[model samples]
Target: MAEKAEDTGVIAWLVETVKTVFWALVIAGIFRTVLFQPFWIPSGSMKDTLLIGDFLFVNKMAYGYSYASCPSIRIARLGVDIGADDFCGFIEDREERFFGADPERGDIVVFRHPVDGRDFIKRLIGVPGDRIQMQDGLLYINDAPVQVAPVGTFDEVWERQGPLGNTPSCSNGPVGPGSICQKERFIETLPNGVSHAILNVGDRPGDNTGVFTVPEGQFFFMGDNRDNSVDSRFLQANRGVGFVERKDIVGRADRVMFSSAGRSMFAFWTWRSDRFFKALD
Candidate 1:
């Protein structure tokens, strides 16, 4: 009788623990699906504005949650690639819940890469029906030149040693040692009165692009690191992310929750304390 009682008690405790864990996961899933999702910056394309190692929370409700907005596990269970171009089936049939607003020009958005379906974050430069062009590194929207004010020069050199292979040199980066790269920085103010810093590495091919008309229900995005980014200026056929459809956008990046300058998360000395909780313009 004593043995049976002990076994019963143990089973009861196990059952209770399982129930607690299950409920916790459920609550977490709900929070992640309805509120915000975390993302880490992996590239320097948005340099100076958003840096590599910057971790931010994307506000999913900023532009509403579509079918692609479902949590990854749920999406996986559905047996579909949520990042695919046709994940939402049809552009006209895309469904969103709690639709509160639309993304504005100058907003940094996280969206599915139009070609490969990878998640990418960039500043929304053109809305539907907007004409965008870059000439000699100057940006023009609807034939009006956007204001570009010189900020200063950005110089940095860094080394990356990790599982991905050792990168001994980096340009305009936070890495340590080696060849230092200098780039001109400028403040670009959009027509909507939103201003942010942009890096210019002289003139590149992207600096002289033909006029691009944003189609209905599509948006043009660009990286702050003008010369280095492969954004809407290039075509998808050329391995560049072209115009992103509205249904592909995941959310808006509102702020930097945390940032690190070191190679490892455990490196306390490399923490960028000043960038913590920094709001994106």
Candidate 2:
């Protein structure tokens, strides 16, 4: 009887442990889906604004939830066929059901790439029905040149031995081995009074662009690294991200949660302590 009671106690403890773990996973999934999701910067497209190793907590609820934001779930088709379109058409139409406020200009947003459905982060530059153009690397919205002021030069040491591998020490300019590349930095103030730093690497292909009118229900995005970013300056047909639809947007990137410059996670000294908890402009 003593041995049997001991066995029963062990079984009860195991059951309770499993129950706790199961509930913990469920709660964590719900929190991640409805509130915040973590993201890591993989490229230098946003440059001085966002670095290659910056980790950010993306606010999922910032623009509300849609089918893209949720985990995959199989659901039976239940809507009546109104004879207006085919079954696939109806499914695509109802796939996106967004709530909350729309994203504003100058907001750094993470959205699904329209062509390949990959997640991408860029600053929202043009809204629906806005005319955007670039002349000599200067951004002009609605025929008005946005305020841009030269701040200073940006210089950094290029360590060819980091985990990130061959950091671009040069701005929009060319770089050579064992040399320091200095690039001009500027502050661009959007129409909404939100200002951020931008790097100018001299003239590039995207410097002079024809007028682009943002379509309705779509938004235009650009990288702060003017000459280095692909952005909306290129056409989707040409293998670049074009206008992003409203349903594609995930959320705004509010702050840098952490930053690391080392190639290995164990390299504690490569961690950027000053960038911790830095708020994004």
TM-score for each prediction? Answer: 0.87, 0.85
Alpha carbon lDDT of each predicted model: 0.80, 0.80
Clashes of 2: 2
lDDT of 2 by residue, 110-216 (tens): 88777665578999999999999999889999999999999898776655534447467476356666577777899999999989999888778899999999998
RMSD value for candidate 1: 4.1
- For model 2, what is the C-alpha lDDT against the true structure? 0.80
Off by over 4 Å in 1: 73-100, 161-179
Clashing pairs in 2: 163-263, 172-201
> What's the residue-level lDDT of 211 in candidate 2?
95
Tens digits of per-residue lDDT, candidate 1, 159-181, equal 55322323422335443466666
